[model samples]
Target: MQPPADLLLPDLDRTGAVPMLRQVYLALRAAILAGALPPGARLPSTRALGRQLGLARNTVVAAYDQLLAEGFVTGRVGAGTQVSRDLPEGLDAAAPPPPPAAPPAPAPDAAHRFRPDAAAHQPSALPFNTGRTSWDDRSQAVWRGLTLRRLARPDPALFGYGDPQGARPLREAIATHLRAARAVRCDPDQVVVTAGAQQAIDLVLRVLLEPGDAVWVEDPCYPALRAALAAARVRIVPVAVDGQGMDVAAGIAAAPAARLAYVTPSSQYPMGVVLSMARRLDLLAWARRAGAFLLEDDYDSEFRYAGRPLAALQGIDDAGRVIYVGTFSKVLFPGLRLGYAVLPPSLLEAVRAARLLVDWHPAGLAEGVVTDFLAEGHFAQHVRRMRLRYRAARDALVAALAEHAPALAAEPPDQGLKLLARLPAGMDDVALAAAAARRGVVARPVSPMFLAAPPVAALMLGFSGHEPAALRRAAWALGAVL
Candidate 1:
């Protein structure tokens, strides 16, 4: 079929930012919608169109292909291409334009109140900030090599929207790794890959919680998790965490019908106390009796510097009550933004559906690279090397505290990344932290982490991000502030 002689072929731009094919496609699309090319108007064959427009056959074909895919045009076998008879509703000039997007509303007070960890806010900008990970030259080199390999031949399927649950290979890899490393019991089917532990916590709450539902949150816990729960309008029962971790009995007394409880069981945040084996059972028991779920945040449990890593609460759960959350942010790097939630079979469907509604899914490229990182043994290798390096840093920090500031008692964590140093009696930790920040060091106030009154006066100092020299220097400076 040949186009009419009087029909004007759209002009192509060779030097413009827009591709020649896209330009041709847009012009043809606009003409069809404007009724310049009416319904059932036969278009020239690909070769004829190319010759008429002085373009290669492929370019014209590509333009037509896009139009065909988008329903602006149609093609018939043994016939020719024509504009779609049943065009989209808005294509006609008589159709009303879509209403403009409403202006964004102002955020609530809580938006300003809930802050990320100090280390999350460009920790490298200052010295010895909490929650930062040490990235040595070897780790960076290995990461670069993995990234290049992953990019060398990216799967074409990744170009499209990925599975809401996560990439299958990544999930499978995580499941296998968790089973061996963290003693997490799960199949790939039960794993919901999330952006991070933060999102994993949010997703679980979205699935299980309703407005005003009772939720047991650890006192002096991770602020980001607290903010998320607060935003959901749940009644947060601040459960005390002692040497044994969350006081399960106090939580039962406070909120017996609580739908969920968030715990850093393996190593409690800031304090770094391992939840005792007895307490782990008590928590699991409470969840079973109350028909509640336990969200175990197994963050940084892999880097146990002393005895063996404490068993994760998720590992021992036979009642299918624990929703295990783990993140690569601390172990691998914060920017990776990769994490997983091992849900019980009962909650899998609801959680996966909820995840689809929020952000759809994480990027496939990052997941794939991490999948390869684990499968190729790089993850274990990195953890082994980092454990040794961080253990050294932790020891140096503790020793420096003993030498420089004997008043500030520092007990190194057997597991996890940071340590809690108790301040002098009546010394305001918030004021001390502010003072320390001004001196180019981060001593996160422990009182703010507490939800109940009469909070402990302490500072949380991280040693994982810095070398021994920097850790020692930061400790000496903190002593001067005290």
Candidate 2:
């Protein structure tokens, strides 16, 4: 009798670099991950699968045998091959519970401090959220490998409470990465590792600013910065940005008395503008004269698409005014939640104390893995590969928008992974974004990034996490919603 022909098989092209068995493994793994082939789904016989994929029966048998060894499949004489029913106990779907009821109100001071309105400050949706990276399996494999190696290490340091600042090796790795990739000059001792960039921001605010002290945050800047500063009781002064970058002259004029100025100069958040050399020098000079420090967030600067990447502000700060912040969230993965702050020699002790008072330090094992990953150059290689992939995705998004959404206009950015698309006059970006989300496309409104009042209506679309084809479909879907 003949075998059933409905079983799916992976089509492997000989021209690709991946091995055939690995491709087959990935195809089956992806099917499982997507729930396309549910647990206990029947698989085809090895002989039947061989014919479908144009491979020898032994090759098919070998692939299935490996799957069985990995506990991903099972077999019986009459039952044929089937996906494992056990599924490691957590693979099956489950329904989520409903939310709890509201509680009674509290006293006046308590109510004021614990107002429900605080929830409004939290981001409802993360459409086009900045600093997101592609979370593909290839990247996961690298991290997993690093984790396993770290687990095998016999050192007691791996299990102990890490230094409140960070692991020395990880700090050294960061110093090397920054100097090579960002042109920033700093010693390993100057790097203070934290949970992530947000934590670093909080630490900087706590250590540097007192209540009522003024700080300059870029107008239409990263909203979280405003919240962080507000939570620290620092008065925020908005400084506008132009094509060159943050308006340095305006920042000096508006907040000359401010103690610190936060700028995303490498690729300004929401706008994706690179700070030009002239403006960088001007801002550095202004900070020196105003006796203010510059908090330069160079997040996602590794993915520059245009000419040579710009040097970080810290590299050029002769006055010891730049507090440089960077994160592995974009370079590695966000879930790792590792970031570092490179402070001038003067601020090191204060920032270290704040970090110690907050969370003590980030995880030791994760930091060790990252240290190995960076030391071995895997992080650099991953960044290089993703940079090319992101450039392609960005171009695809641009072309698709131009073809499908003629009414929308995107300001081309010289660097960075995201860009702003201006809606035609009369269209409401906030409403349009709501409609887009319903269609499975996550696009954010540009208005909320602004301070006090919105200056324009636009959408911020991120291309780093998606492929070229997927980005095109997302853009088309967005157009249909509009």
Candidate 3:
């Protein structure tokens, strides 16, 4: 069949980082999947396509070969190439075509609600955005090398459904790392690998909570965890946090019968307060008395700046009531989507069962690569390098805030990626964040982290993702907004 006169060729971005052949493949694949090219429709010959697109025939061949290998197209002698008649699932010709692309909509009103965390890491987005963790080129190169090595081995275990509690080797590696770094005490058998801390928290809540059970949450807690608890149909009692972190007595007074309490002990989220040892013991005692479990999010414990890093809450929990959760998102790259939960001996079987039913384990390839990362000493080296770099960034950020935004005050925490600055009295942090976002600086409001009316206005500014200079620039921008 002759090429359709109106068939639009894929637009290539010559300066883009994507390879030309891969771009061609993706465009053709999209056209086929979108029904722009009908099933069994003939594609131009490689030679013809190369000529039409003004390219070398080998480049066209490379694109066509990839499509053929992926079953997106088929070729035969004399018939040339055609869109695959047996399309992959959900790409059927009989399936309704997607609606035409809508024209770009007008920008919403300035007061329109926007999620501050969603676009923090966009290529063009502002720097110093909360929850944005940096992955340097060197680290990415290391990860790529590790990933290639894993792919070369072609493990049969990775090809099959992974162990629900996670790969044994990976679990062992995690246990060893936790033992050394965070002082978490657990056997490999007690660990359950999850698709990041979010899923880890979700799995724990699934196994532990019944409908409408009261759970204690830090007043200004991680929003994602709160959402998970709500989804599980649990009542959340928001307990206050101070310099000592979540007040155990306050939590007891708020929800004495609460079945579980989620706390970030090493470095509390949003507000970078390390739960004092006294408060840690107090919380543990409360949990024991109430016969409840503590979900300890040991997120970002690796980036301590000032003093020696505090031991994990789970380390001192002799009562076996603490479920220690940790993630590679902050330490490594967030896209890795790898995290683990160290369950107590009592809850191990139930959590494993829940994990099996929930996603049946995280991606085996990531688990395997990360296992190698931890075992081969790359993980420790990377963390040390990041710690130094982030410490510098944090110091610069604090200095900039003091110089530029003197109205805001923040004491640098010994650990974690973000610095929480208390806003001036009567100032609206949410509004300030919105304004800063409009001006291309992502400043997250601490108010939304609260369950009730926030007692004070605050902003959580991230420093780990940006360089010292970039952090200064973001700080200057934030000061202007304030």
Candidate 4:
């Protein structure tokens, strides 16, 4: 017979000062690690655990939620929660072990076809990754407080599945915020909340493109966008971008029966060029002519450091071909995994159905907290503060690069958090990046952002997270590496 589930928890020592919930969590986790609670073992229900430990049911539930978030355990409908079947190797063992023996070698030309994108494999050590925020202690405290408050509410809906479209409060809040900040005209019914910008991209691809359909993407665009299109098995035609952004005439001329076109018009990634108004008009005309959907990834448009903020493509899209993708990752934090898409009326139902089938919806509590954050104006205030801070950092980076590495040419942009520094003709970006890593400065090569061939040798450095002083130091360190 199996041991009682309540007996799985370890006895607590009287002298420990740790919080009861934390102690219970650690003790239960320790049992799993020690194989005292083996794989497939069903954990006691929250009520039973609370009774066993003389704690509140809510405390046990919170512990379980943490475990679930961390992939330690899983809860199922009707069935009790159980330990994850694929625990880390040797984690269930009692003793520390040695390395395993090498496996047999593969035959030559073994048809091993899986190859990940180069950008995905690259080591990321930068304080501000693409679409990430500078999360300080205060933000963490706010998140914790919100989580605890949500936990206190007695709602079965919190534990069960949520509306695939997303929580109504968040969708409504996003609609209000976008209208005021981005000049986007939309209602709560038009907003479709997603896991992140990536998920929004995927949903758009699924709803708009069928297998073998053609799509046009910016030549040196975000690599993940390229990866997503490739995964969908759609043929992607690369449209070259100039200083003013993607060349509209060239894109129109090269259109190969494309069902959609993806562009970052506000501030192009890696290159950091805002699409000119004339070109934006020309591109929209082409979309109208070809009956193509345009995906506008407004990833980092919030922190425009130069001149007046440009109106979004969606705001100006009269032909109803633009699908606007926005995310809170840049403005608030990345790990929250909150993003939204404003779809054209024609594609709304199809995209909503696709989202329903794919992961149902984002976490309910996260949506609720973010909704409250935006409604209370904390989100807007934070964005304004970060915009100013990022501008200062951008200015410092440009000045430092000019002072230290005079030979290198740094392309200055009117807006966006990241800038590209064009390296000398023969210098290898990979080698320089490796050297910079040794000096504790992180930067990415722009070559990996290209599709067909490397069009330029440059380094993409983000200034959003680092302050001006830190950027100056990092620039000096990078100058040494180069």
Candidate 5:
């Protein structure tokens, strides 16, 4: 019989990686599965098919043989290969049916803490996004050069499984940087290099917290913290954040017996407020009395445009109550996914076990690159240059808001990559943010950060990753959005 032009045989790639016969078999199997070739439909003889496809008769015959063996097609001496009616049905019957979709099996008591919005901080480019990090030509070239050098002279061990606590040299470098720059009280031995601050958060939750244990988290908090707390099945007690950061008094009044607490002490997230020394003392006292641990997420404390300087909570805690979390995402870039937790000596092995269970360890080659970056002092130099650029971006954004969108009150931050822009009272900040996003500005709503009713309507504007000119253009477009 004469063959048709289309075997719907996917175009044969004679020069491709896959063998010709296997490719042919796959194409014919796909056609059968897709119902393009109905049951009992006759295939042309191997010789005729070979001619149509420009393949040798042997290759076509071999392809047909595979399909026959797989039961997707049938062949007899007189009747040429034909599509099998029962193949797809039989395959489906062999596999188990899919389960119905349902909510995740978080502890029933902690279900209320798992709000959907907490997990919604996705990436957006340009004018304002908490997720992006600043980078210029100088920093990019340095990073590329360092990375290429590592790739060229790879350590054989990098290809093998890595240490769960991360590479020893990287941990030592991180400890050195934290001690000098952030006043963190830690040594290389106590440091557990994590994928990022989020994984560090998850590691702490796994190692220390038990299901249904009450935990203190800042109200209007960093969403990722809230989500992680909930996912770990801890009862998240929302402690109100005032000008002094997380209100320790409020947390005590609400959940004094809480097992653990999470705080961004150096600079409160979203609001960019520092924890006053008085409040920090009070928090440490509370943890001591309650015999609880504190997670001090030192988020975005690096770029202080003004102030005497912020100290890490972990640096001050002598009682070993603090688990200090810091990330290179803000300083380097979010894609690096490298962070470290300065754990208490007591929690070291437990955290290591939890890290092993979670993801084994952070990527090795990146760790190697960062170790050199810190050891050779490129990290400090890069941070210094990027500070000036980020400061300029912040100023430009604030200025643009003043010029075009005066109604939105912007609090240009003295620290951190983002600032809070208050919307008019009674206005919906979430709706305004959605509108701004449509106009290419990633304005995050401050109201959604709160667990309950928000006291104010505002947007969080990030400035670290933009050029001054780009920030101005985006802010003007955002004004148009307004």
Candidate 6:
């Protein structure tokens, strides 16, 4: 064995501008690279080196610590420190970087279809941004408390891998909440927790429909749902929406053999029309006869301004035809990204398996917090409080529209976040929306939302997420543009 003192380090430069620690580190690194200190050669202990160089022991130790971190040296108890047996390759400082190379193509599945769009990210405190919901201060404090409590508990499962089907306690709580509030027919075993309603929709599509297989979606439906379906590479059959909601008769006429139908029955997105009870029965009957499935997105059904929210389409579903999807994002907050699907016995395992294939499960910590919220009745309480706040904001928007822009036909929706305001006949809704955006408002044109029924010239203004004063101010600015 070579004695540690035989290692020849440079003389200490204590009087120079460079820190003694940095100089020590640089000297050792250079020695290792130049082969002055060969691989596996012993290094002097910090005390011995500091005494020889007349520097502090900490400076020498600091240099050795860096060398160890960078794989230039290794240390072990009793054996002391030595040069690394396997040193990491280092690039020559004068060498040029290699040329950029093209990436390989993605897999031939729906994975290739996804790309981020700004529409989901655009909802904000800005007036008329439809994807947001109003929040309260006290409720936020309560939510923070629940989250902290989850971390304080000493549970080993918190760090372990969780079930792909989601935590059983949270599923049980979600099942109970759905049964009581939306009248959904399911047990805890039937629910599969997901990142949000969007994931739940994607999972159902990939499992049930093949590429080019036809699926019926509501015209003027949620844009994100359409994006998911297109990403799955399935043929989307756009059915028109009437005052009664999705025209089921037109769908059957167009493609009765379609594998699935996605609808928001309780409150149609953007249009805000509840599916008539007669139509609901007819759709359910059609699904059973055709051996197809209906995905009921009960997204904002909890905050209806009318007497009470309507029962979910799943409640009336028999023959295992309905797959119910819902999210806690709206009532709690959007960032929570917690949503669930109540699957029929026929599709339970398939969806859970698809979930595993896509992403192994929702965050366990978030699941735990939601479970406590639902079981403690905090979820229901939060919904009740938000309903009143949203109603006030809705009223403000309606009054502002009528007062400021009378040419725009507007009506207050009974139970949804947005309202449809008809523009003057022959006016360009797209141009109008662009103008609104330039004026610091987010207005969505309704013409693009249509399937084929002569496009209606209208704009969709969201009301739930803005304050009354802010809504009024936005409406006044919107009037000037109109």
Per-model clash counts, in order, read 0, 0, 0, 0, 0, 0
Segments in model 4 whose C-alpha atoms lie over 4 Å from true places = 1-115, 118-131, 136-148, 154-156, 452-454
Off by over 4 Å in 6: 1-27, 30-45, 48-55, 65-93, 96-112, 115-117
Of 1 and 5, the candidate ahead on TM-score is: 5
lDDT tens per residue, model 4, 346-397: 9889888999998887798888888778887777777777777777777888
Clashing pairs in 2: none
- For model 6, what is the error of residue 476's alpha carbon versus the real structure, in angstroms, after optimal superposition? 1.0
Question: Where does model 2 exceed 4 Å of error?
Answer: 1-131, 135-138, 452-454
Instruction: Report lDDT per candidate.
Output: 0.85, 0.80, 0.84, 0.80, 0.84, 0.87
How close is every model to the real structure, measured as TM-score? 0.76, 0.74, 0.75, 0.74, 0.81, 0.86
lDDT of 5: 0.84
lDDT of 1 by residue, 366-396 (tens): 8888888899898899999999999999999
Best by lDDT: 6
- What tens-digit string does per-residue lDDT give for candidate 3 at 1-482? 55565557767888869988988888898888887787778987787777777778999899999999999889989888898878755563476689999999987764242333443335443676656677777778888999999899978987678788899999999999989887888989999998888888888888899989999988788877776776777898989888899988988888898999999988777677778999999999998999999999988888877776778989999999999998999888787888899999999999899889878778988888898889999999898889988888889999999998999987676778888899888999889988988888878788877776355688888888788888888888888887
Candidates 3 and 6: which is better by lDDT?
Answer: 6
Predicted structure 3: lDDT:
0.84
* Model 2, span 1-482: residue lDDT tens: 22335656556878859777777777777676556667778877777777788877887787788888988888889888888877854554554687797786655652332222232242322434445677566767988898887788745975667788999999999999899888899999999999988889888888888989999888787867777776676688988877787888887777787899999988787777768999999988888888889999988788888877788988988889999998888777777899999999999999998898889878998888889889998887888788888888788888889988878998557688888899998888888988887887777788767884456799988877766777777778888987
Give the backbone clash total of model 2.
0
Where does candidate 6 have its weakest 10-residue lDDT segment? Answer: 87-96
* Best of the two (4, 6) by TM-score: 6
Superposed model 3: Cα runs more than 4 Å off: 1-125
> Which candidate has the top score in TM-score?
6
Residue pairs in steric clash, candidate 5? none
lDDT of 5 by residue, 1-482 (tens): 32344565767787868998888888888777666676777887889888888889999899999898878888888777888766644432334677989887767765665665632566657568776787778878878999999999999988899999999999999989888888998899999999888889888888898889999888888777777777777788988888788888989999999999888877787777788999999999998999999999886778888864587888899999999998999899988999989999889999999899889888989999999889988899988898888988898999999998998999788888888999887889889988887888888888878885355799888888877888899889888988
